[model samples]
Target: MGKIVISSNVTLDGVVQDPDGAEGFALGGWFHRFAGSKDLEDWAARETAELLGVDALLLGRRTSEWFESRLRPGGGAEARVSPEWADRMNSIPKYVVSSTPEPPRWNNTTVLNGDAVKEISELERTVAGEILVYGSYQLVRTLLEQNLADELRLVVFPVVLGTGLRIFDETGGKPLRLVDTRQMGDGLAFHTYEFVRG
Candidate 1:
């Protein structure tokens, strides 16, 4: 069985919105402000490794479109993930959860318009490696609500966005056990948490 790992670059305030400023938030591009530090580079390397470990990806419609637009042929390199990350993303099986039909311009992408919980649960049964969800906050919430996610890996940045689209919902009471922690030189905190069930 595969593990459902929820990953993100969030703020101290649990705000996961518009880190790259691509979404046009007022505090957009906040994550880019810390780009030049060696700590960020190391963090990126760690993220790349974690992402490469996944055999499949679960992404929401918007996030999927964002990734597909940048990852398609002849797209600007700056608009995509790192070279290593790109290689893994292109090769892995991507199941996009979207109600609408979208022609995926990227390679190895599949659209799953059925029930989120049922489709993802079925995917977890057959996948031998990790099934990662990155930058898909809505899908993450659904997975957590259904108790389907196995691990939560958060790369928290130093900035605190006072207001933004947060990952935690009002009824978000999922139990998580701390599994790992690493503080980077650039003041970023890397945390790994496993889903806990009574």
Candidate 2:
């Protein structure tokens, strides 16, 4: 069985809305606000390390589209990251959870339609190794609620946005077992939690 891991960067307040600040959310871009800092570089290196071990990627349609626009080759953020990183991202298999009938246009992407939990559970059974999820807040909530996610790796930044879209917004009580915790840089906390499954 595959491990479904939700990996994301969140602020102190749990805000995961828009780290790049490209989105127009009132509190968006709290993540990139610390550009060029030693802490930020540490955080980026940490993310790169995680990506190195990732077998496949699971994302929401919107997040997938966002990556397509900003992380793809020739995209806005493409010029900033290493070419190896970009190539690895493009080579990995991506599964998008979307209700839309139109297929995702990104390379090596598959769309999962209908019944999120069931689809993901089947995905878990079929694929081996780590299936990392990034920036799919709603889908992450569902996975948490339904006990489908195996692990959650959160890179907690220092800033708190007071108010914005949070990852655990409406998620009910679910206990987690801390697998690992470490400080990446001066301000970032890297935590890994495993969902307590019966």
Candidate 3:
């Protein structure tokens, strides 16, 4: 069985919106503010290590489109990251939960056209390792609400953005067991929590 892990970079205030400033949110680009810091570099290294173990990626429709636009080969965004990292991202098996019939344009992507919970539940049964979810807020909420996600890995930055779209906005209360915690440098706190399912 695959462990559905939600790996997110959130602010101190639990805001998950527009970390990269791509969406034009008022408080956007909070994540890149610490781009060149030693702490941020350490935190990114840890994230890279975690990503190395991921077998697949689960994404929402909008997030899928966003990645397609920014991360695709010859798309100009590949210049921002290392070749190996870009290759891993491009080659990973991706499943996008989309109601629309239009297929996702990213390489190695498959559109899950039916019910979100059912599609992901079936995916969990077939996948053998970690299925990482990144920047898909709506999909993350659905997974939490439907009891589909297995773990939550949050890299909490030190800064507090006053307001933004939070991941747990409309999510119901779900118990979590702390599995791991790591302080990356002085600014980043990495925490892993396993969902307590009955």
Candidate 4:
């Protein structure tokens, strides 16, 4: 079976909201506030390249909506994606886990409206490469609860948001194994962990 990887950009306090400054929330854009140094950028680039190898990209409803809106014609955040990044994104297959959405506007996107774990499991069994999940906070929570994630790639910035979305919910659980951890020059940290099933 292929691996299911969850990659996210989170603050020191675990807020994974709009880090790109596109969201209207005053405190939504925290990623830019904590600028990382060269070491951090190099680490991020390597991680991103690895994630791009995943056969499919899984997204939550809200994240799918945000991406669609930004990629939409005449959208305000259309400039967010550079030409190279746009091409890279377009090359990957995207699967959006949503209930209300009819269909996504992206060229290579599929709508998954059923049980998240079952669907994801089936995809892993049939897909040829890793399954990557990015930025879908709610979906990530659900996957964690169901023990569907095989690995977690956390890019933690140096700032903290006292009150915002958190990476881990209050679902009582055992500890995860800290597979690896690295500190970057810009105070950014990279942590790789795996759920230690009993």
The lDDT leader among the candidates is: 3
Q: Candidate 3 residues 114-173, lDDT tens each?
A: 988888999999999999998889899999889999999988877887888988989868
Which pairs in model 2 have colliding backbones?
none
Once model 3 is optimally superposed onto the true structure by TM-score, how far is the C-alpha of residue 86 displaced, in angstroms? Answer: 0.9
Candidate 3 error regions (>4 Å):
34-36
lDDT of 2 by residue, 62-112 (tens): 989987887765678765676666777778899999999997788999999
Question: Candidate 1 lDDT, tens digit per residue, 124-167?
Answer: 99998999998988888888788998998988888877999888
lDDT of each: 0.83, 0.85, 0.86, 0.76
TM-scores for every candidate against the unseen true structure: 0.93, 0.94, 0.94, 0.85
Write one digit per residue (lDDT tens) for candidate 4, span 102-167: 877787888889887788778778777778887888888888888888888888888877877677
Q: Indicate the worst ten consecutive residues by lDDT in candidate 2.
A: 32-41
Candidate 2 accuracy as TM-score: 0.94
Pitting candidate 1 against candidate 3, the one with the higher lDDT is 3
Residue pairs with backbone overlap in model 1: 21-29
Give residue 150's error in model 1 in angstroms. 0.8
